[model samples]
Structure formats: C-alpha cells, structure tokens
Target: MTAADWHARAAAITPRTELFIDGGFQPAASGERFDTVDPATGRVIAAVARGDAEDVDRAVRAARRAFERGDWSLAAPAERKRVLLAVADGIRSHADELALLDSIDGGKLITATRQVDVPGSAAILQWYAEATDKLYGQVAPVASPDLAIITREPLGVVGAVVPWNYPLETAIWKIAPALAAGNSVVLKPAEESPLSALRLAEIASAAGLPDGVLNVVTGFGVEAGAALGLHPDVDVIAFTGSTAVGSRFLEYASRGSIRPVWLECGGKSANLVFDDADDLDAVADAVIGGIFGCAGQVCSANSRLLVQRGILDGLTERVLERAAALTVGDPLDEATRMGPLVSARQRDRVAAHIASGRDEAELLLGGDALPGDGFFLAPTVFGSVPDDARIMREEIFGPVLAIAAFDTEEEAVARANASEYGLAASVFTSSIRRAQRVAPALRAGTVSVNTVDALDVTTPFGGVKQSGFGRDLSLHALDNYTALKTTWFAGA
Candidate 1:
C-alpha cells in the first residue's frame, strides 16, 4: 500500500482504549488512562488504560487461576499447538494492520514492519507451536529393579516485559514460547507501543485461546512492570529492554519469591574487519546495516567498528558514501530506507551523544539531526575514537558508529572484548582459522562470522555479563519457562 493509504487505514482503526484481561478488553480498576502518541507525528493515537498495581494484581490473578484450573496448562500438547498455530494465522491475516500500528507507534519504517517484524512474529509463533508436541522427556539409566524418568513441566505463570523497539516481535518471542510450554502469561508491553500488543490479545482470543490464558496490562514500567516483577504468583519473568531496568527486575525478583528472571538487555557490540577480509565492499555494506538498520535501536546492534589499521581509511570512505545514499523520510513511504527515531526524546538523546562525539572523536560523516517534521537524524559516523570515549563505550541506540583501528589480531580481540556489555560481536574474514579463533574469544553470547546481527528462529539469542542472561529464541528458550522434574519408581 501507498504511504497515504497506510496512514488512512491506521487512522480508521480507532486505537484500543482498554486493558486486555481474562481474554477480553476492560477498563482499569482505578479508571485511569494515558494517551499513546504516534512517535512519527507526535500525535495522540489513543488513550490506553493506565494499569497500576491494582491492574497487575487482576491480571496476575487471572493468569494464576487459568494455570491452577488447568484450563491451558493441562491441555494436550497438540491442542496447545493448534491454538497457537491459529493465533499465528490470525497474525498473518492482520499483518498489514499490525505493521501499520507498529510503524506509527514506534516510528519504524513501515516497509520493515511489513517485510521483517510482522512476518517474523508470526513465524516465531508457528515455530514454537510446532515444537510443542516435539518436546521430549528422558529416561534415566538405573539399576534393573529401579526406573527413573525426567520430564519438563510448565511454570505456572510467566510475566513478559517487552520493549518499544520491535515490540510485537519481542512480545511474541516471550509469549509464544511460554504458551507453547503450557504456561499462562501476563504481558506488559512497552507503554510507548502497546497498540499492536493489545491487538494481538484480541487476535489470540479469536483464535480460541482460553480465557485468562494470556492477559495484557498497559501502563508505565514503574507501575505495571514493577508489580509484575514483584508479584509472588508469577513463576518466571522474561524481560527485554535496557540494562538498568533489567537490574530492577532482578531486584524485584529478589524482593518477591525469587523466581527465575530471564533478561535480554543492552549491547555495544563490536564489528571487526581484518586486513585479509576478501570483500571490503561487502564488509562496508554490513557495517552500515549493522548500525543503521532499525535506526541502531537493536540490542545486538554492531555500534563499535574495529577495523585493521591498514584498510581502515578505505572502508570508512566506502561506508560514508553508502550512508549518504540512504533515503530518510516518513516511515510509511515505501521508498524510504530509513525513518525517524522512536520519539523526540530519543532523538534528542542521540543528538546529545553526537555532540559529545564532536569533542571526543574526528567527525567523519553526518552528525546532526535532519531538517524535518519527525524525529529524523542523519546516519552518523565517528573515526579515531579513543578507547575510553563515551561514544565508543556507551550504547548510543542511534545511527551513530564509532570506528577504531587496531594493528594485530590480539589488539582487535582485546578491543572487541573490552566492554561491560557482551551481547553480540561479528568478525569479517575469509580464513576459517580466524573465524574459529575469534568467535570463541569475543565473550559474547552470539558471534557472527562474515556477517553482523544475523539471527534466526532456531538459533539461541541472548547476552553475557551485564547485557543480561538466558536465551530468547530456539528450543533452549523453553528452559526459561519450564521446570525439569525427576520421578523414580522401584519394582519389587
């Protein structure tokens, strides 16, 4: 659809103004509400129910009841798979609408929502649904008279706190796996982009999910998120957002029942390009996409570039030329390659980082915000950045790249590994030896060879150190939602 058509359609679907609980939309107990604005236009789209501790209590009660009654938890694996697949189908049918909601609410390119986010969300649901029935138990070896078996059981209730960037996809990343493991979930989507998540609740209900199996509370993180994190009834909390907030979740877990918390937080990942790399042009393209893709909002974004000193100048020039060619404008425009940041506040924050960059590093390319209506900023790059520069060490979460040069493999690995965050790292080289050597030495949960930010549904994704713990995708993710149980019986 054209940009105008997409905007018109988005306007036509009056935004949902209620909280989703027990499989239905309802007003908050306190009757409080907050306006959700379109980040691209700074216009209020809807007055969503402002969920507080009271609302979280209600949602938790609903989830707990559903789990205790075995309405969904005790259901057959095939039945759960059928319902989840149906929900996936619902998402596919409403792809355009969902994509529009995400684009406007989060200021992401509508084309990306259509081509990447929405479809990826559906595929994740389907992948987990198919794996539900395939989950297997183990029979332990023992003496002839004794038999031991180990099996996995769903945690009673799961609380999922998703962030604004790729809200729908990240929400499903938690929700799909929790449900497939036969657990009722309480989803607290980011307050900035709650519309699509509310829509997903409706679709899941229509897809025949049991009432109370999946509930959503829309409100500020301090209110709803903290309550979910501290609620004793919640057996597990899966959160994806900033590192500071991830720490809060840990604190809440400690203050509550000490339930396991799965956190996927921030990153300042490094992208290393060696002198022996076969394709400088391709490496340049990957470097641009690493930081520019998703407006550099991704947690695993390769924001730090560690280039070999010999080829640093040539690659940096190529990257600058490509960055200048990128089209930046309204998110709904199909021709637009880059869109505004999620909000004016985020844009200002990025601008401040750029200002600091001016003093700390050599400004190699764009650094200022573009002249426009929305929160637009030119893709920025900084060269000769000191190892201790704030722009190099911090998570900018914008289209800002910090380039540093190193002479040897040891220096490259040392610079890449020297960070408080170790979420993701990439090495570009044709040598199998370097790929094997560097991938393991990076200290990141995910390391890509000859690629950057490359992820799939079947592969585990997460971080190490302060970037948070636990996997998000793949069958391994089920470990966060399910508990292992051992049973033994002796034959007389």
Candidate 2:
C-alpha cells in the first residue's frame, strides 16, 4: 500500500491508553493521570494513564508473581523460542502502523521509521527468539568427585525505562532479550512518545505472551521511571537514557543489594575521516545520515567529526553544501528528508548550543531554525571547535555536527579518546593497514571503519566511561536479566 494508506491505518490506533498490568488495561489505582504531548506540533496527543509508586507496586507485583509462578520461566527453551518468534511475527505484521505512529509521535522520518526501525525491531525479536533455545550453560571442572552443573535462570522481575526517540524499537531491544532469557518485565515508555509501545502490547499478547509477562507504564520519568527502578520487588533494572538519569538509576538499583542494574547511557561518539579515505562521497553520506538522520537523537550518534588537516578545507566545504540542501519540514511529508527535533525544549537547547557556536567555534553552515510551526533547527555544522567549548564537549543532541582537524593518526586517536563518553566511534579510511591499526585503539564499545552507525542485532551495543556500563543487544544482553546457579552432588 501507499504512504497515505499506511498513515490512515496507523492513525486508527486507540489514542486513549492506560497502564497494562497483569492481563488487561486498567487505570492507575490512585486515579492519577497525565497528558502526552505531540513533539512535532506541540499539541496534546492523548491523556494517558499516569502511574505513581502504588501503580509501580501493583505492576511489580504482577510481574514478580508471573515470573515466580507462571508457565513462562519453566517452559522449555524451544517453547520460549516459539513465543518470541511469534512476537517477532506480530511486530512485522503491524509494521506499517507502528512505523507511522513512531514517525508522528517521535518526529522521525517515515522512510526511516518504516524501512529501518520497524523491520530492524522485528529482526531483533526474531534473533533473540532463535537464540533462546540455542543458549547453553556449562559444567564446572571441580577437584572433587561430585557432579556439578551451572544453570542460568531468570532474575525474576525486570524493569525497563526506555527513551522517547526510539520508544518502540528500543523497548524491544530490551524486552525481547529479557523475555527470551525468561524474565517478566514492566516497561516504562517515555511519556512524550508511547503510542507505538502501547499498541505493541496488543500485538505481543496476540503473539502468545502470557498475561503479566509484559507490561507498559506511561508517566513522567521522576514518578514512574524512578518507582520502577527503585521498586523493592524488581530483580533487575535495565535502562537506556541520559548519563544524568542513568546515574540516578544506578543509585536506585544499588538500593537493593540483592539485584544489579544494567545501564546503556549517553554518547559523544567520534567519526574520523582520513586523507586516504577511498569513498569521500559515501563517507560524507554516512556522516550526514549518522548525525542528522534521527535529528541527532541517537545514543551512538557520531556528533564529533575528526577530519585529517590535509583535506579539511575542501571536505568541510562540500559537506556544508550538502548540509544546506537538507530538506527540513513536517515529519509526515514524504519529501521531507529531515524532521523536527523531538520537542520544543530540545529545540531551544539546540538553539542555545548554536548561539554559542559563533563565539566558541568556526561556524561553517546552517545554525538557524527552519521557518515552521514545528521544532526545526537548520542542519548545523561547526568547524575548528575547541575541545573545551560547550558545543564540542557536551551532547548537543540535535542535528548539529562539530568538526575538528587532526594532523596525524596518533593525534586522531588522542582527540577521539578525550571525551568522557565512549559509546561508539567510526573511521573512514581505505587502507587495511589503517583499519587494522586504528580500530583497537579507539576507546569505545563499538567501532566502524568506512561506515557510520552500522550495527548488527547479534552484536553488543553499549559504552564506557560516563556512557554507563553493561550491554544491550546479543547474548550479553541476556545476561542482564538472568542469574546463574550451581548445583553439586557427591558421587553419582
């Protein structure tokens, strides 16, 4: 079907949503409520259920009970795989609707939301589904004649606080793996953009997920998110958001010494372009798409560009020409290449960073707003940004690209390593020697050469330093929601 058909199908989703606790939709026990705003138009999207500590307690109770007594954790691994694969199919079946909801609420381009996000989300669920049956524990080599077996078990109830930019997909990024590892979850989706996540529960239930196995709580972060993180019954907390918020989660998780929290936080990643790069045009395309594609809302955004000094002038000029040509408009428009920032507050924050760019860095290109009713910032580029400037050091989190020049290979590595964040970095180099030599030295969890933001669902994604710890995606992610127990018996 065509785009308009997809939009109509997506718009038909129920706007009035409530907390998904246990098996069905219900209001908060305390009667609390809140309004969810549309980021694109600054209009009220829906009045959603607002969960407080009591709501959290109820949700946690449901999740804990389900994990401890339900058929989910005790099911054969193959059965779990079947459920998860069906969940994947469910996601794919509703792909058109989910993509449109994401596009409208999160201010992402429909092309990306439909082509990349939804399909990728389904693929992730499927991969985890297949992997559920494949995961194997080991037997210990003990000194005694006793038999020993190491078993991996679900960590009871899990709490996941997902971000607004990638609500549906990121939710699955955490939920699918956690469920595949056999844990029930209470997902707290960002209040600004939770439509797709709410809709997904129907699809998930249709996929055969047992009641209370998956739940969604919609409310402000300080209330719902904090309660979920600090809930006494929660066995593990998995979160994806900012460094500041992540720190609070770590603190809350530590409140219960019995359980550990797994965090995936911020990033100020680097994309280094060398003089010997083979595909300058392709590298430029990747660079632009990396930072501006999602309005720089990604945790692994290549916000910093380290270009070799030799080709700096020529490359900057070419990149600027392309940046100027980027189409910024309403997210619903098929011709609109770039959409608005997620919120007005985010737009103002980006504008402030742009205001400071003139005094702190060499302003190369667009740094103003696109004339519109939406939160649109011009695709901005700054050259020769000093390391200490706010525009360079902090996460601008908008469609702003800060470029720096380095003379030597060692200098590039040094410059890239200076950030307190180490989530991801990319290198554009033609030579195999450069790729081999440089990839290891980069101090990030994920590194790509001749590509930008290229990630596989099967590989791990996370960060170091202030970017937070633990991992998301892959089997490593499964470890976040599972615990191992050892059994031993003397002489068989």
Candidate 3:
C-alpha cells in the first residue's frame, strides 16, 4: 500500500486495550488504566488495563485450572497439532490487524511489522505445530525382561514475559513452543506494547484453543512481571528483556518456588572487520543494518564495530555516509526506514548515552534528536573509542555505533569477547581458515562469519554469561518447557 493508504488504515485502527484473561477481555482488578502513547505523534492511542499482582494471580489461576482440567495438556498430539496449525492460520489471516497494532503501539516501522514481524511470527508458530507429533519418547536398553521408558512431559502453566521490541515475534517464540509441548501459558506483554498480545489471545481462542489455555496480562514489570516470576504454580518462566530485570526475575523465582527461569537479555555485540575482508562496501552496509535496524533495539544488535586500524577510516566513512541518508519519521509512512524510539522516555535514555558517548569518543556523525513532535533521534556514530568507554561497554539499545580499532586478530577476538554479554557477534574475512578459526574464538552463542545477527528458526537462539541461558528456538527450546520422566518396568 501507498503511504496515504497506510496512514488512512492507521487512523481508522482501534486497538484492544483490556487485559485478556481466560477466554475473554476484562478490566484490571483495581479498575485502573494507564495511557499507551503513540511515540510517532505523541498522542494517547489507548488506555490499557493496568494489571498488577492481583490480576497476575487471577491469570495464573486460570492457566493452572486449564492445565489441571487436561483440556490441552491431555489432548492427543495430533489434535494439539491441528489446533496449533489453526492458530497459525488465524495469525496469517489477521496479519494486517496485528501488524498495525504493533506498529502503532511500539513505534516500529509499519513495513517491518507487516512484512517481517507478523509473517515471521506465523511461520514460527507453524513450524512448532508441524513438529508437535514428531516429538517422541526414548526406550532405554535394559537387562533381560526389564524395560525402561523415558518420556518428556509438558511443564504445566508457563509464564512468558516478552519485551516491547518485536513484541509479537518474541511472544510467538515463547508461546508456540510452550503450547506445542502441551503446556498452558500466561503471557505478560510489555506495558508499552500490549495491544497485539491481547489481540493474539483473542485469535488463539477463535482458533479452537481451550478456554484459559492462553492468557495475556499487561502492566509494568515490577507488578505483573514479578507476580509471574514468583508464582508458585508457574512451572516455568521465560523472559526476554534487560539484564537488570532478568536479575530481578531470578531473585523473584528464587524467593518463591524456584521455578525454571529462562532469560534472553541485553547485549553489546561486536562486529569485527579485518583488512582481509573481501568487500569493504558490503561490510559497511552490514554494519549499518546491524546497528541501525529497528533503531538498534535488537537484543543481538552489533553496536560495537572493531576494525583493523588500517581500514578503520575507510569503513567508518562508508557507514556514516549511509547512516546520514536514512529517513526517520512516522512509522506508518512507507518511506520511513527508521521510526521514533518506543517512547519519549526511551529517547531520553538514548540521548543520555549519546551525551556520555560525546565525552568518551569522537562524535563522527549525527548525535542529536531531530526537531519534530515525535521522539526521533538521528543515527549516531562514534570513532576512536576506548575499550573501557561506557558506550563500548554498555548496551545503548539505540541507533548508536561505537567504532574501535584493533591491530591483530587476537586483539580483535579479545576485545569482542570482553563484554559481560555473550549474546551474538560477527566477523568479516575472505580467508576460509581465518573465518573458521576466529568464529570459535569469540565468546558468543551465535557467531556470524560474514553476516551480522544471522539466525533461523531451525537453529537455537540464546546466550551465555550475563546475557542469560536456555535456548529459545528449534527443537532445543522444547526442553525449556518440558521435563523427562523415566518409567521402569520390572517384567515386560
């Protein structure tokens, strides 16, 4: 659609603003609501239900009751698969509506939400649905007539806390696998972007999911998120957000029932460029996309650029030239490649990072907010950055790229792996031997040899160190929501 058509559609949209518990939408227990502002226009789009501990408790109880009733947990694998496939189909059918909700609620580019986030979420759900019946139990070899059977069973009542960045995609990453394994779920979407998840609950119900099988609660992290983490009935808690909040979830889990907590947190990932890189221009393009894509809100955002001292100047110039030409404006506009930050508060946080970056390194390109009604910040680039600089060490989580120079491959690897986060990293080189050698040397969950943040649903996605643990995609993710039970037969 053209920009005018998109703008018209956006204007006509009315997002869901209530908490989705069990099979229907309802107001919060406290009857209080908070406004979710549109970052692009600085207007209140909707006043969403303000869920707190009581609301969370009610949702968890619903999930637990549904699990105990065996409406989903005891369904035949084929039946479960059929229902999940229907859910996937439902998501596809409502793609535009879902995409619009995310774009307006989260300040994501409309094109991205329509083309990438919604489609990817549907595909991920379908992939998990197709894998449902393929999962099998194992038979352990035993002596004589004795038999041993090892079967994986669903962990009932999973609590999923997803971040605002890529809201639907990340929620599907958790929800699909958890549901595929026959577990009931209580989803808590970020307060900033709750509309889509609330609508997703409606879609799932219409797709033949049993009542209370999937629920959505929206509120701030300290209230709703803490309740989920500390709920004794919650068998597992899966979360994606900042490291500080991940730590708080850990504490909450520890203080309560000690449920299994899987976290995918922040990162300051580095992209290494050696002089032997085959295409400098292509590498520069990758650098731009790696850091500035989604305004650098990605968890695996390659915010740090480490280039060999010989080619640093050339590569930095190429990246800056491209960063300057990017169009930043309203998300609903098709021509805008970069939208505003998720909120004015986030823009201010990013501004703080840029201010500190100016003190720590040379501001090579844009570092100021644009003059507009929306919360817009120009893509920033920093050069001659030190290893210990705050911008280099911390996750700015914005369109900020810090460039540093290294003399050798050893130093590059050392510098890249120095962060507390081990989420993702990238390396660019023409030599096969160096690519193979350096990839394993870097301390990260995923290392892209010549690409940045390369990933697929077929491969596992997660990180080590403070970035947290537990896989999120592929067959491995099922392990996070299920546990193996061994049964022994004395005389089979």
Candidate 4:
C-alpha cells in the first residue's frame, strides 16, 4: 500500500485509549491520561490512559489471580500451544493495522513495520507455541531405591518491560515465552510507543487467551513500571532498554522478592572490516545498514566501525556515499529508507552525540539535524575517532557511526572489546581462519562473520557486561520464565 493509504488508515482506526487489564480495556483508577504523539508530525495520535502505581497494582493482582487459578499455568501443554497459535494467527490477520499503528506511534518505516516487525512478532508467538509441547523433563539415573526427576515449571507472574524501538517484536520476545511456559504476564511497553502493545492485548484476548493471562499497563517507567518491578507478587521481571533502567529493575528485584531479573540492554557493537575482505562494497553496505537501517535506534546497533589501516580510506569513502544517499522522511512514505527518531528528546540526544564527535574526530559526512517537522537527524559518520572518545564509548542509539583505524588483528580485537558493552559485534573478512579466530576473541555475546546485525528467531540475542544479561529469542529464553524443580522418590 502507498504511504497515503497507510496515513489514512492510521487516522481512521480509533486509538485504543484505555489500559488493558484482565482481558479488557479500562481507564486508569485516577482517570489521568497522556497523549502519544507522532514524531513525524509532532501531533498527538491518541490519548492513552496514564497508568500509575494503582493501575500496576490492579494488573499484578489480575495476573497473580490468573496464575493461581491454574487456568493458564496448569493447562495442558497442547492447550497452551493452541491458544498461543491463535494469538499468532490473530496478529497475522491484523498485520496491516498493527503495522500502521507502529509506524505512526514509533516513527519507524512502514516498510519495516509491515515486512519485518509485525511478521517477526507473529513468528515469535508461533515458534514458542510449537516449542511448548516439545518441552520435556529429565529423569536422573539413581540407585535402585531412589528416583530423581528434574522438571521445568512456570513461574507464577512475569512482568516484562520493553523499549520503544521494535516495540511489538520485543514485547513478543518476552510475552511469547512467558505464556508458552504457562505463566501469566503483565507487560509494560515504553510510554513513547504503547499503542501497538495495547492492540496486541486486544488481539490476544480475541484469540481466546483467558482473562488476566496477558495484561498491558501503559505509563511512564517511574510510576507503573516501578510498581510492576517492585511488586512482591511478581516472580520475574524481564526488561529491554538502557543499562541504567535495567539496573533499576535489578534493584527492584533485590529490594522486593529477590526474584530473578532478566535484562537485554544497550550496546555499542563494533563492525570490524579487514583489508583482506573480498567485497569492500558489501562490507560497506553492511556498515550502512548496521547503523542507519533502523536510524541506529536498535539496542544492538553497530555504532562502532573498526577498520584495518590499509583499507580505511576506501571503506570510509564508500560508507559516506551510502549514508549520504539514504532518504529520510515520513515513516509512512513507502520509499523512505529511514525515519525520524521516536521523539524530539531522542533526536536531541543523537544531535548531542554528533556534536561531541565533531570535537573528538573528523566529521566525515552528515552530522546535523535536518530541517523538518519531525525529529529527523542526518545519518552521520565520524572518521579517525580516538579510542577514548565519548562517541565511540557511549551508547548513542542513533544514526551515528564512529570509525577508527587499527594495525593488526590483535589491535582490532582489543579495540573492539574495549567498550563497556559486549552485546554484539561483526567481523568482515575473507579468511576462514580470521573469522574463526576473531569471532571467538570478541567479547560480545553474538558475533557475526561477514555480516552485521544478523539475527533470527532460532538464535539467542542478548549482551553482557553493562549491556545486561539474559537471552531473548531461542528456546533458552524460556529458562527466564520458568523454574526447575527436582523431585525425589525413595523406595517406591
């Protein structure tokens, strides 16, 4: 569909203006509301219920009741699978509407929302649903008088807090596994982009999910989010956002029930391009896409570019050319290659990072904010950035790339691993030996050879160090939502 079509549809669909709790939409207890704006137009798209501590308390109580009732937590694995599959189908059926809502609310490209984000969200539900029935318990080899069985069981109440970027997809990353593991969930989506999540709650309810199984509380982190994180009844808290916020969740867990906190946080991933790389052009393309494809809003964005000194100039020139050519406009525009940042505050943050790079490195190209109504910043690149430059070290979370030239393999790996974040890294080289050697040497969680930001549902995605802990995508993610119990039988 055309951009105009999407814009019209987005305007036509009545915004869901209430908090989703216990399988229904309701206003906040205080009746307070906040407006969610379109970053592209700087206009309010909808007035969402401004949920607070009381709303979170209600949602948590609902989730706890659902878990204790055993309607979802003790259901047959196949039954849970059936409900999850129906949720996935519901998502697919409403793909266009969801995509449009995401574009308007988050300022992400409509193409990406339609083709990648919405589809990815549905696929996550389906994948976890299929894994439900396949989950198995292990029996320990014991002496004749004793029998030991290790089984996985759902944690009662899971509270998931996701970020604005890739909102729907990340929500699914947490919600899908939590539900498949037979745990009731209370999801708190980022306040900047909560529309899609509210819509998902509606979809899941329509797909036959029991009341209170999947609840969404929409509000600021300091209020509703804090309530969910600190709620004593919540068994686990899964968070995806900045390192600072993830740390807060950890503290909440410690101060409350001491429940486990799973975090998939920020990153400043390095994309290392060696001189021997066969396709400099392809490497250049990966560099552009890695940082700018999502306007560099991704938590695992490859914001650092480490290049061999021999090919540094050539690769830098090619990267400049591509970054210059990227089209930034309204997210609903079908031809837009990049969209505005999620909000004016985010745009200014990226701008501040670019300004810092100007003093610490050579501004290669595109370092200024564009003149427009939306929160648009030019795709920026910095050359000869110092090892200790703030732009190189900090998580800008925008379309800003820092390039540094290195001498040897040792220096490349050392410089790449020097950052506080070890979320993701990419190595572009032709030699199998180099790929094998460097991939293992990098401190990041997921290292890609000849590619940048390569991810799928089958592979686990996360980070370490300050980037935070815990996996998101694979079957291993279920570990965060479930607990292991060992049963012992003696002299049966």
- Per-residue alpha-carbon lDDT of model 3 for 1-492, expressed as tens digits? 887887788778778888888899989999999999888888898999999999999999999999999979999989999999999999999999999999888999989999999999999999999999998999998896988999999999999999998999999999999999999999999988898999899999999999999999999898899888988889999999999999998998889986799999998899999999989999999999999889989999999999999998888889999999999887888889898889899999999999999999999999999998888899999999999999999998999999999999999999999999999999999999999999999889999988999989999999989889968999999999999999999994
For each candidate in turn, the TM-score is 0.99, 0.97, 0.99, 0.99
- lDDT (Cα atoms) of all candidates against the true structure: 0.93, 0.86, 0.92, 0.93
Model 4, position 382: C-alpha lDDT score: 93
lDDT of 1 by residue, 1-492 (tens): 788998888778876779999989999998999988776677888899999999999999999999999969999999999999999999999999999899989988998999999999999999999999998999998888889999999999999999999989999999999999999999999998899999999999999999999999999999999999999999999999999999999999889897999999999999999999999999999998899987888899999999999999999999999999998888898988888888888999999999999999999888988886678899999999999999999999999999999999999999898999999999998899999988999989999999998899999999999899879999999999999999999979
Compare candidates 1 and 2 on TM-score and give the better one. Answer: 1
Model 4 Cα lDDT, one tens digit per residue, 288-403: 99999879999989999999999998999999999999999989989999999999999998898898899999998888888978899989989999999999999999999999
Q: After superposition, how far is residue 4 of candidate 2 from its true place, in Å?
A: 5.1
For candidate 2, lDDT tens digit of each residue in 1-492? 555665576567666478888878889877877776656667766788898888888888888888888589888999999988898898888887888888878888888888889999999999999998888888899867788899899988889999988888899999988999889999999887878888888788888999989988888899999998888889888889999999999888777555787888899999989999987778788888888888888888999999999888877877887788888876766777888888888899889989998899988888897675778888999998998888878887888999989999999999899999999999999899998989999999999989987788878999899898879888889889888899887785
Global CA lDDT computed for model 4: 0.93
RMSD of 3: 0.9
Clashes of 1: 0
**Global Cα lDDT for candidate 2:** 0.86
